[model samples]
Target chain A: MTSLYAFVAGPLAWAAFLFFFGGLCYRLLSMLRQVRQSEPFIFSYMSLRYSLRSILHWLIPFFAMGWRRNPILTGVTFIFHISLIAAPVFIVSHVVLWDEAWNLSWWTLPDAVVDVMTLVVVAACLFFALRRVLRPEVRFVSDASDYLLLVLTAAPFVTGFLAYHQWPAGPWMTIAHMVSGELLLALIPFTRLRHMLSGWLTRAYIGSEFGAVRHARDW
Target chain B: MNERHKEPSEIMDDGVEAALSRLTPEKIQAVINSVLKGETGARFKAYMDTCIHCGLCSEACQFFLSRDRDPHYSPVGKVKQTVWPMVKNKGRVDTDFIRRAVRIAHTECNLCKRCVAFCPFGIDIAYLMTVVRRIIHKLGATPLYLQDTAHSHASTMNQMWVKEDEWIDTLQWQEDEARAEIPSLRIPLDKEGAEIMYSVIAPEPKFQAQLIYQAAAIMHVAGVDWTMPSDIGWDNSDMAMFTGDYEIMGRIKRTHFEAATRLRVKKIVMGECGHAFRSVYDTGNRWLGWAQPPVPIVHAIAFYYDLLKTGKLRIARKYSHPVTLHDPCNVVRGGGLHEKARYVVHQLCDNLIEMHPNREHNYCCGAGGGVINCGPPYKNARVAGNRVKAEQLFDAKSRGAHTLIAPCHNCHSGLHDIVHHHGIDLEIKFFSDIIYECMEKPDGSE
Candidate 1:
């Protein structure tokens, strides 16, 4: 059991991190290289201002322009992503594990906060999955990989929550959670999860291109 | 048969049907491979990798919404059905597949980029669709009417095929009419060092000579130093750009800039044509390797705004009808002139009834992006696909709008169709129409 956890938490985590960061840098640099082939810069001073303003505007999920239109989806996605990001980094149990591994630690979220976040993440993941099943438009576009990605995102949290609560098969659940988390990290660069990096690049390009080239405000 | 499910060849003329028959799978594959491998780059790669197929973009598409929210009409769905298979199979898709791709990419989507605003990642779906168009164009599979228009551009340098003599004659005729209004009014031809060179689409000379006459009066009243080129570059509209004939698009735009450079004009003021403005300012200029227009160009909305704001032209009496404005997709959405356009509208109009979702979020007129120039074969389908816009127009009419002002020429035609086809009673007018009605006329004075 210790060997299983050690394999997932040690070598597997390092490998996943290397793949995630290296693949991300490679993709971004290649995209930047293509921009060099674009027509010469019209050099609008307003482009920089608009791009920065839009970046700040769209950063908050609630503050994005159309959040009110799809409140429930926005709410669930907000809870899912915030908890997904927060519980993995600042939760007390995860911090303790990190400190034990590398003598690295930071301020920890309260146990109650982490527990609620885990439940929210698990519930939100299911909501998203069920939506794909029931919503005809969404269902039509979704393929097998969409469902699989949702499961992969939720598996770590579900297992971690169970293990943290000392549920049945406790040690087994911890190792499973570690493995699932590492799998997600490794999948980031290769899958739609790459939107984390590419989304920023594409969004900024839209704002900058509109502002600088057309001299038009997107908003 | 339901309008949505009708086959492409059912609507195609014999010439286009024969063109489709001539296309071989190998030719299609070669064109698709060349574009995917050469024209596209990492930006394309990023967009493809990042789309989660959430169907949010479907909600933004009028085609999808107007068709009872059919998933097949979604922007992402359009890409998947048309471009994705070609990319995955390395362009080995068959002729039937290419036919359906031409209909969807060319006839259905307006390439308006409205979906870009609604998308979380701001994926420029229009750009992807244009890549599909470039491939299809190279394979010689464009629809006949639009292809004929593109050929006109290639041969005569104008979409309407107006002869060089006919173009000059129309200008002289409009000049004579304007002189009747203000006897000293002149439509200066090839006047070197004029501050502005006025350009118009070919339909002006062929069908709507009165627009030229009105513009001459406006220019006369504004007392602007402007000239209309007597030569080939007077027609600013490029249907070739919409057909993805980049070589022809480049030639049209280059001739325009060269004419302006020869005249040493500070800028070119184009008439109220949305797609033409987009060609000179955005797509065609980029194809010719200019980041912006070589000489600055202003759309009619901006030019009108300038004349009004600077007190060169003033409304003598506001048109006192309950009116609403249709925001042309290319200018309002593409050029970001919504605010300036609204200012001009309110300046000339009284009792303005604002439409729901005005400005950047406004629905497309279903006529820009060469969808109308795809011509009469698909007119019913185009009008049916814009039922959402008809609903919006009805809503505006119920609130007391007697006239719906559309500033772009294509919007004028498209909105006119929606009004006529749907039996909606609102009158369609361009900003130029309303401006000419209300503006103070000169009495042979400065």
Candidate 2:
């Protein structure tokens, strides 16, 4: 039990965090360097104004153009993201673990709040999976990995919830939760999950190019 | 029967068929490899990596919608069908794949940029398709008619193959007709240092000389100092830009700009042609390494908006019939002239009906992006695939839009087909059409 805990909590945790953040930095920097090399003069006079405004506009889910066209998907996406961040970053248990692990801690959400968020995360994952299954357009583009990514995303939260309540297979579920959480983090830079990091830059470039150069309100 | 009403499977014209026959597996692989390896840069890589395959962009595409949501017509699907395999296999794709890729890039997508607006990642799918076009252009697999049009641009400095003497003659002919309305009106030729040089697409001379007369009438009535060049650079339209013939695109743009610079004109005010405006202001200029046009260029929509705003052009009487404006994708969506266009429309027309999705969100007219230049073979599928646009026009008609006003020449041609093929009893007009009828001619000139 001690060996298992040490490997999961120490070495594996270090490897996952390093890969997640290091790979993310590399991806971002490489993309920026390549864009600079291309020398695409983003044709706009008030480019920064549009870029910042668009970033803010899309950051709020309701204010986004996509929200109007796709309310259900937007709502589910918002819930999934908020819960995904909140449970990992703000939950009391996670904060205590973080404090003990690295002398790092912050204000934490109540257990009840964390519980509801986990449930929302789980539900959102299901909704995404169902969309892939049902929508013809979605089905056409999706493959096995898309569905697997959904299950992988949901695994940690599901396991964590079961571990919290001391459900059957409690000890095994705790280890499973830790391993799946680390795996999800490590996979962020390698999968479609990178959109979480790159979405703001994409939205900004689009808004700036269209709004400043074209002088049309794209967002 | 008009080509727009023909069945889709029967519509790949002889030009496209001929181009397809020229393709070989080795040529296809080599061209694709060279393009992917050398031409594509960070933006392409970023877009390829960032697309999540959510299929949200499908909803924004008129082709996809009109095709009953066929995934093949979706923007991402277009990329998947054309470029994905090339990238995955490192350009070892077979000739059949290359043939399908050419059709998908040239005929299927209009490069409207609506999908860019809707994309969660804001991916410029149009730019990706343009890269495909560049590759196909290199392989000599470009459609025969469009390639010929580009060749005409290369050889004659015009897409219609109009002779230098014939171009000047058309201007003289149109000038003679304009004199009946205002005898003092002159289609000034080779007048250097004019404030404006008016340019038009070649089809104006070949098919619609009357539009030249309308423009001449407006210039004379408004009393603006403008000239029409008699030289080879007069045609501002570049089908080569759409065909990915960058060399010819550069030549056409450089010629147009040099003509304006030679005359020392303040700006070039182009006639009602959207894709030509795009060529001068965006793609062609950028290709020539000019971030901006060497001499400023203005689309007719913006030009009309300015004239009305400055009271240089006054309304004698607004057109009384209810009319709807079909926003040309290049002028409205690509150029950001939607509000100015609306301002002109409201000033000259008594009753204006808005299309369902107007302005930047407007669906393409299925004519621009060189699709119409693909000629008769592709026209049927072109119109059929844009059934969403037809429906939008029909809805506008249902609301009592007696005339559908498309300000750009390509939009004028494309929307007219939609109206004709769909059997919608609506007249198609340009902004000039409404303005010519409604603007006050100076009393002495009249």
Candidate 3:
């Protein structure tokens, strides 16, 4: 990794942690101040159990054979997700940086695999982005924030790839990728990314709660 | 043979078809503007901004799949149909667009809120759809039957005018019938100091009186200390939750919580319905600025789970038939009851067939968020729009599910029509009915 890229990435990493945590708190506090559910179970020990199981639900597919439901969307989402997980793991720069930060190490994949996964992520993100802009079904409701996130997402991949080429890559490109990547990380807690961690409880509770009400068997 | 092609002018359009042409621009813009203003703020902003497309919601939407993959019927298409028009025109769209928006908002899509669960963003497309319906409703563009229900709620507390006497008489009748099943079972009405107060929507009295009977039987067998309020709040479900009439929604929710408070009950046990449960716990309760119900409101699903988990209720006769479940948007997604439902189902039924994408990922029963409240005039359209759900049920039927158990009132009603209109020969059962049937009856009459 270039010294300049590392320097930029270092401050950006701390920036990511601070922004995400601070923003999430600000947003959550605003929500609490506004639409507070007074008797919301402070002690949802049981609900917590349900949520924990759900967080690891998608992990099963990577280790096991298949999914619980619609194969097409599940499969597409799985491939996309797996690609994302791989990009972070295989990047030699990321591996060394994480090792320095946390004193942890796993085997890093070969450079070829790293490049392949990054390319896949780029393609996948493009698929989603194009759908947002071209499809009227999507275009109708989408706002500037939607477009902003799409462009924000592409930044990491674009900068990373350009740096990989290193021909046209300069400090600006590397800096842009590192900065955008950090921004996205920061946005995760405050933005819709909470859906990933929080969706399990919300979705499962909704499913099973209604299931019990209807006297249905499975959620 | 087929004398079908009557000339266009001489066709003599009547019913909802005739009234469609009479729609005016003045009415349309007023309603659209009002709805836009009300549906502002964070929830609206997050919803508008979170789409990256990916079209995963298309598969989850019954309308899109049902309409032969018409992009127009897709969940996203629904937004484009209604909101996009308003947005593009800066809230200055025409009457024809308004008419289409009314159909799309009221009938084409149910505000089941199922799409929100599937979307990675949790964008709450259902809330957006409701906002559109709220606009249409203001314009008097809503279909006749749903409008009538709203009117009923406006004048009478209940959407169905089961009068004061009718309400009490029906409860008494149900009590008497249930007493025959379990001699000591009491359907105590307006009893003070009870730990739990029981409530149901108006449909339970107006149409499905047997639900009251079934619920009473279960309460008796479980030996739960409960009382029913003979007052305005007795009907806990509000159709205004669908109609976007927040004022009426607040009134309905207030009446429900107030009635339970009047009875001095520690908690309220609502009957088997999701949206109603949501109204008290999530939507209307929030609308009225109550953080939570003055009395903790429990849906029948939660009550059943507690009864079973506590070993208070046991089934001597397990239901042996193969059964499938429909996820009601409210209790399932909104309240998070998927596992508890599975727990009860495994305990009660013999062979349970899983719906693909079950739980939070499941498709809506198509009656939720007030889609059913849209009424009979749009019945065929509702059924038509939900062809995908019909096919999903058909697939479950092929997998050998002879019975479908839907826990929520709206889901049951919606699934009933989908099953019938599609001519699927399957029986629909509510969990309460099954719980009542399978539970042990005490040796004497109440």
Candidate 4:
């Protein structure tokens, strides 16, 4: 079990980070090249001011009309995203690993807080899964992969939470958590999760079009 | 769930029906592949990749809201019904699928960017729908009436097929009408080096000649040097843009801009039409490789706002009726003239009662984006689909607003249909219609 954990936490970890960062850079650079070749005029319309304005408005919880209308979904989304980033980065074990690897660290969240954050992420993923199955509008657009992505997103948090509490299958849960988390990171650039990278760009394009050209707010 | 399960009305469009009759699987695959591969680039790919399909855009759409929150009418749902299938199947969709796609893209959706505003990632569902339209256009399957308008633009450089002589005669006729009110008034035509060149959609010459007369009176009263072109470019509206016939759209916009260039006008002041403003200032110009319009084009809302702000046009008396304003999507959301429109309304009217979700967030009139030009075949569905807008109008009327001041021409027509169909008793007027009645004229009229 320890050997398996070592495999996942060592070589698998490097491969996932390599694919995540490298794949994102490739996708972004190729997109830029494609834009330059096809619709180079997009660059002329892009404005930093509008981009920041749009991004800031959307980033704030319930700031956008879309967020305001779907109160339940909005609440879940904010909790999920905040937990998704914070728990994974600020958890003591991960920070200690980072410190041991490169001698770098940031302020860490209390383990108790991160524990609750992890459970919130797990609950949010379940809520999203239920929504995909139940909500007509959401179900119409979702497919098998969407469900699979939800499971993939939740697996790490669920397994991590179980491992942290040292549940019945503690060591196995730790390996499962590391593997699922690494797989999730690696798959992001190739899936709908690519929105993490391109969402801001899309927001910037729309904001510039609305703000600079149309003289309207995008959000 | 039962409400969501309602089937879409299968409106019989002869153009789509006829095109489907001629289309083979290979032809469908060919046109879809060509557009997807050749025309679209990074923006297309990025939008496709970035959408998480959370369905937040559904509420922003009137179709979805009016249809009892039917998922099929949601902006994302519309795209899923149209473009996603083509992309997933690599353009191998059957004729029946194409027919449904035509209906969804052309009839069901308005291409208003309200969904764009509401999306967290700012996914442009309008752009995706237009792609579906482009493929349909290549398949020669655009709705019959809209295609006829595109043909008119191709042949006459105008949507209404108004002949050169007829256009000039319409201006002269309006000039005569305005002259009866103010004897010295002139609808100046073909005047070179004019300070402003005024342009209206072809509908003005075809039917709404009175709007031209009102515009002439306003120009005369304001003491502005404005000329109307008695040429092919007099019409600023482009149905071709909506038809996905970019070639014809580009040609129409080019002629319109060249007319202003030829006249040496400082800017072209467009009549109150939202889609025409979008065609000239946004879509058509971008297609023609000009990021901004070649000649500065001002929408009627902005022009009137400027005239009022500069004290060039004075209100002799404020209109007494409590009125509400319908913000057209293109000019308000597309042009950001919401506040200015309110200022003009307040300047001209005594009591300005605003509709809820006013300004840039207003519901579309179910007309702009060429849906109204789809004509009578789809009118029932179009009117029925925007029940939420009817509710809004009713709510405004209940609040003591007896009149609706819609500045854009398409909004006036669409709102007229909505009010009539929904049994909402409200008088509709253009800002110019009220301005002509309330502004101080040189003849001391008003």
iRMSD (1 decimal) for each model = 2.7, 2.0, 6.6, 0.7
> Model 2: residues >4 Å from true position, as ranges?
A40-46, B1-13, B443-446
By DockQ, the candidates rank as 4, 2, 1, 3
TM-score of chain A of each: 0.88, 0.93, 0.72, 0.97
Tell me the tens digit of each residue's lDDT in model 2 across B1-446: 76646655445556656666887777777888888878887678778778878888988888899999988888888988887888988888776676678778888888888888788678889999999999989988788888999999999999999999899999999999888778888999989989999999999999899999999989988989999889978999999999898999999999998989888899999998989988998889988888778888999999999999999999988898999998888877678998998899899887899998889889999888998888877877888889999999889999999998888888888888888989999999899988988889885554
DockQ of all models, two decimals each: 0.52, 0.56, 0.12, 0.86
Tell me the deviation in Å of residue A156 in model 2.
1.8
lDDT (Cα, tens digit) per residue for candidate 4, span A1-219:
678778888999999999999999999999999999999999999999999989999999988888999999999999899999999999999999999999999999999999999999989999998998899999999988888888989989999999988895558878888999999999999998999999999999998889899998777
CAPRI accuracy category, model 1: medium
Best by lDDT: 4
- Scoring model 2 with DockQ, what do you get? 0.56
- lDDT of each structure? 0.85, 0.85, 0.70, 0.92
Flag the better candidate by TM-score, 3 or 4.
4
Mind giving the per-residue lDDT tens digits that candidate 3 earns over A89-138? 67788888788889977788887787777777777677666766776556
Tens-digit lDDT track for model 4 on B66-96? 9898899999999989988899999999999
Clashing pairs in 1: none
Which candidate model has the greater DockQ, 1 or 3? 1
Among all windows of ten consecutive residues in candidate 3 chain A, which has the lowest summed lDDT? A37-46
Please give the range of 10 consecutive residues that has the lowest summed lDDT in model 2 chain A: A38-47
lDDT of 3 at A16: 86
Report the C-alpha lDDT of model 1 over B192-239, residue by residue, as the tens digit. 999999999999999999999889889988999999899888889999
TM-score of each: 0.96, 0.96, 0.73, 0.98
* Candidate 1 Cα errors over 4 Å, as ranges: A37-47, A61-65, A215-219, B1-10, B13-15, B444-446
Listed for each candidate, the true contacts retained, as a fraction, are 0.47, 0.46, 0.08, 0.82
Give one digit per residue, the lDDT tens place, for model 1 in A167-201.
Answer: 86558888888888888888888888989898877
